[model samples]
Target: MIRTATPADVPVIHAMVRELAEYEKALDEARATEEQLREALFGERPAAFAHIAETEDGEPVGFALWFLNFSTWRGVHGIYLEDLYVRPDRRGGGHGKALLTELARICVERGYERLEWSVLDWNEPSIAFYRSLGALPQDEWTVFRLTDGALGALGAPTR
Candidate 1:
């Protein structure tokens, strides 16, 4: 079952975040603390929305984090998925597609113009799965990010 996450789900979410980071070879970059996560998604002003996929026996198998973005050109809200993960052993059971489909439902409910996310170029399997779901990759755009290390190396004076 897919449901919105609550503050009570923080512990499991934290653990899953670490697990996902490890899977992506980014364990060291998993910097979220339980308190931080709790405050972000469950705080007075929610930073984002999160959902967990659990089984009939009540074991969480996957999660997805997303937020809304405004697109001026489209003149509508877009559902931007920041992260989606399922345990490697639990994959091939349709959990991923179910999660994505749920997100699509949310978009329709909210009248969102788009549902979008980025996938690592080398993750061919995921690319194929997304393509099968009728998602097209924007080959014309390049994604860029600013890392803390990169910022530090810039030697800008602190406030």
Candidate 2:
């Protein structure tokens, strides 16, 4: 069963995040602390939300963390999935697909124009799974980011 995550789930979410990072070969970069996650998810003004998938007996298996984005061209809001992970041992049992299905349902219900996420170029298994869901890749788009010192410098006052 899939349900919206609560404050009580922060630790589990944080752990799964680390597990995901490990799977992606970037565990060293998983810097989010439990307090940070709790604040982000349950703060007075939340910036994002998450859903957890649990076994029938109530064991957590996976999660989908996402936020809403505005598209000027479409003039509508869309769901931007930041992370989606299913435990390695629990994969192949439809948990991943089920999580996505729930996200799709949220989009349709809220009149969102699109649901999107990025997968590593080398993640063939994930790519195949997304394709099986009829998700198309935005080949024309290239993702760029500014972070740490670069991000700070860009936002600094002109001298």
Candidate 3:
């Protein structure tokens, strides 16, 4: 079962975020805490939203955290999926697709113009899965980021 996550789901969601960070080789950089997760996801004015994946009997195995984005060209809202993960043993089932489809349904119902996300270039399995879902890579554009300390230094480029 895939459903919108509530405040009570924070612990499991935090654990899965850690697992995903570890899998992506960024465990040491993860700074998420239960309180932070709860506040950002369930606070008075939420910064993001999540969807939980559960078994027939109600066991959360994974989740996806996403939020809205605006595209000036489209003049409509878009959903940016920040994270989508399932446990190793839970792969090969339909959970990932189900989660993605549910999000797509929201996009349709709410008149969103598109849904977008980024995956590591080296993660072939995820790339293939996304392609299989009818998403074509936008080869014309490149992704860039300036995180942590570098973000503040962006205006001071040096030779």
Which number leads on TM-score?
2
User: Which of candidates 1 and 3 reaches a greater TM-score?
Assistant: 3
How would the candidate models be sorted by lDDT, starting from the highest? 2, 3, 1
Against the true structure, whose lDDT is highest?
A: 2
Model 2 residue 80 distance off true place after TM-score fit, in angstroms: 0.2
Q: Name the runs in model 2 displaced over 4 angstroms.
A: none
How well is each residue in 1-159 modelled by candidate 3, as lDDT tens digits? 999999999999999999999999999988989999999999999999999998898989889999999999999999999999999899888899989999999999999989999898889999999999998888888988788788878767799
Candidate 2 accuracy as TM-score: 0.98
Least lDDT summed over 10 consecutive residues: which range in candidate 2?
A: 88-97
lDDT of each: 0.89, 0.96, 0.93
Candidate 2 lDDT over 1-159, as tens digits, reads 899999999999999999999999999989999999999999999999999999999999999999999999999999999999999999998889999999999999999999999999999999999999999999999999998999999999997
lDDT of 1 by residue, 63-143 (tens): 898899999999999999988988888898888898898999999998998999999888899999999999999999999
Model 2 residue 15 CA deviation (Å) reads 0.1
- What lDDT is obtained when candidate 3 is compared to the true structure? 0.93
Candidate 1, residue 131: Cα displacement in angstroms equals 0.9
TM-score of 1: 0.92
Q: What lDDT is obtained when candidate 1 is compared to the true structure?
A: 0.89
State the lDDT at 126 in candidate 1.
Answer: 92
